[model samples]
Target: MDVDVLIVGAGPTGLALGIDLARRGVDALVVERGETLAPGSRGKGLQPRTLEVYEDLGVLDEILAAGGAYPVGMIWTDGEQVGRHAMFDPAEDGEEGSRFTGPWMVPQWRNQEILLARLRELGGTVAFGREVVRIGQNAEGVTAHFASGAPVRARYAVAADGGRSAVRRALGIPMAGETLDPDRALVADVRIPELERTWWHVFPPSGPDSGFLALCPLAGTDQFQLVARLSAGAEPDLSPEGVRKLVAERTHLAPEAVTELLWASDFRPRAALADRLREGRVFLAGDAAHVHSPAGGQGLNTSVQDAYNLGWKLGAVLGGRAPEALLDTYEEERRPVAEHVLGLSTAILRAEARRGAATRQLGLNYRHSSLSEETRRDPGPLSAGDRVPDLTVDGVRLFDRLKGPDWTLLTLDSGVFLVRPDGYVGWAGDTEDGLGTYRARVGLG
Candidate 1:
């Protein structure tokens, strides 16, 4: 085998998975079709739960430095300030136990750069310009044939490519979903010197035929992300002058006020989920498994968490610490999560729900999974399948103890809990009654 795991794509999901696997000493490679890393501020919001995952991956400090809090929304009408709108609900007081209370604003491009750098720091490799055209799997391993290079064989393969995944299509996996919006939306990063950096400037449409425009100042960078909805069936002009014209027509800024057009793309929002996340030795992750509307900022966070969930399992199996069957739980645990988050994204896009705790994804759990075992007759608020909140016991941070790639045996006032490497509780009981059985089942024995 060329490598233990072949990750197809170098976006957040693939790079993050590479980092996790590299840290565990798993021989893995991340291959990207693009010559360089992706260059856009696409998924800009990082949820609190993702922050915790970053903390464990040893990149939280860099991520925190490269981003800032989301700015308040400022409404403008007729080129005049009208009102102020908060982008997200205030963080609840009870969430203080967790380090991050709300979402942090880091452009997706910058986020990937950080992940790639960290992956390389751990001696991981990413081969660019290697696009997988076909993937074949057998009982021994999987082989991926690229568009322009030699085929790569590995014990397992993961498809972290975008919603239109070639690996998934090659495997004949169907992506079932619906278009969330008929009107196409334009998203770009531009330098607008006249715009103030303090607020996310919003412009309401003047006429019924027009659509709203918003300019959000990207944290840690001088550029602002521009988003504008176009009329249905209209093609978005992604050129510089065209973007300037759209800005002038939609807001008070003139065509030339947009000094630099960094990157731009247009998309019709949609929600989709793959019929299955795993096909033999190949596993689907991130957008390959599910696609969500860019609402409630769930798509990117959910994708990264998908990597976090699968990383440890792959490591355990590859390191000879767990059986190959452990990989089955990856789809079992993450598909339901992708399904639930897809609904949340659609609800937020339609204004049916507000961005709050649900969007944060801190409450996500896996209680129904076969891995969760609760021997206690009366489990307290915390249970086997729930995320363990960061706590300070005896002046030591719980997250500090759970930072590495190992299971943690934590004892709290309620009971004794066995935490999985992914930070979820795998077993809980008044004592260590059923812990041995659970550990043996998961391959900790």
Candidate 2:
């Protein structure tokens, strides 16, 4: 085999997974069609749960240093300040895991860069400009045939190639989708000189059925992410001139105040889930497995979580520590989570629900997952299949102990509990009765 695993994208999902595997000493190669990392301000919100995943992957410090908190939203009308709105639910000081209470605003490009750097530090590399055109797998391994290069073989492969996944199509896997919005929307990153960075500026349309505009300051950068809702049948212009004209016409900012247009794109909002996340020796992750609406900031965070969920499983099986059945649980667990998260993002996009509790994604859990074994007669707030909250246990932070690629047996607060490497409780009970059997089953010896 050319490598142990072949990752078919270098976005946040692929890079994050690469970091996990590299740290576990797994041989994985990430291949990207683009020569460089994707350039965009999209997927800016890194939710709290994903922040914990980063903490384990060894990139949380860099991620925190490179990003900032979300600013409040400011409404404007006829070039006059109208109202103020909170971007997310506020958190109290000293709250449990308050350090990761809300979403962090880091551009998608910067997040990818940080993950890639960490992957490199762990001796993992991404091969760019190698797009897969065909994929064939047998009992031995999977072979990915590229457009401009020789075929590469691996024991397993992953499709992290975005919403329009070539590998998914090559596998003939169908994607079920729901259209959240028929109207087109423009998403871009721009440098505005006169705009204040303290607030995310919003402007309602001046006329009936007209477009609305919002400019949000990107953390740790002078660039602002500009989003505008377009009228039905209106084609979006991604050019710099078009971006400046849109801002000047819709907001109080002058054309020249929009100093530069960094990156831009247009798309109709929608949510989609693949028919299945796994097929034979290959698996799907990120936008390849599920797509989400831009609202609620769920897409990228969910995608990264997908990688976190699958990475350790792959490492365990490839390292000969766990049974192959462990791989089946990846879909069994993450698929439902993706479906629920899609519902959340779509609800916000359709105005059916406000971006509140669900958008934070802190409450998402695997209680219903078959892999989660709750032996307690009545579980507490942190249960089997639940995210292990960060708490100070005897002077050491729970997260600090859970760091790195190893399952931790937390025998405090709760009785004996087996916490998975991704910070979820795998088994919990009032006592250590079945700990030995469970450990042997999951190869935790």
C-alpha TM-scores of all predictions: 0.99, 0.97
RMSD, one per candidate, in order: 0.9, 1.3
Candidate 2: regions farther than 4 A off: 94-98
Please provide, for model 2 over 1-445, each residue's C-alpha lDDT reduced to its tens digit, 9 standing for 90 to 100: 8899999999999999999889999999999999999999889999887887888888889999999999999999999999999867755543545366788889999999999999999999999999999999998889999999899999999999999999999999999997888789999999998888999999989997788899999998999999999877888989989988888889888888888998999988889999999999999999999999999899999999999999999999999999999999999999989989888888787778887767777778888887788888867777899888778878889888888899988897667689998888999999999878888888876
Clashing pairs in 2: none
* Candidate 2 TM-score, C-alpha based: 0.97
Report the number of clashing residue pairs per model. Answer: 0, 0
lDDT of all predictions? 0.93, 0.90
The parts of candidate 1 lying over 4 Å away from their true place are 93-96
Which prediction has the highest TM-score against the true structure?
A: 1
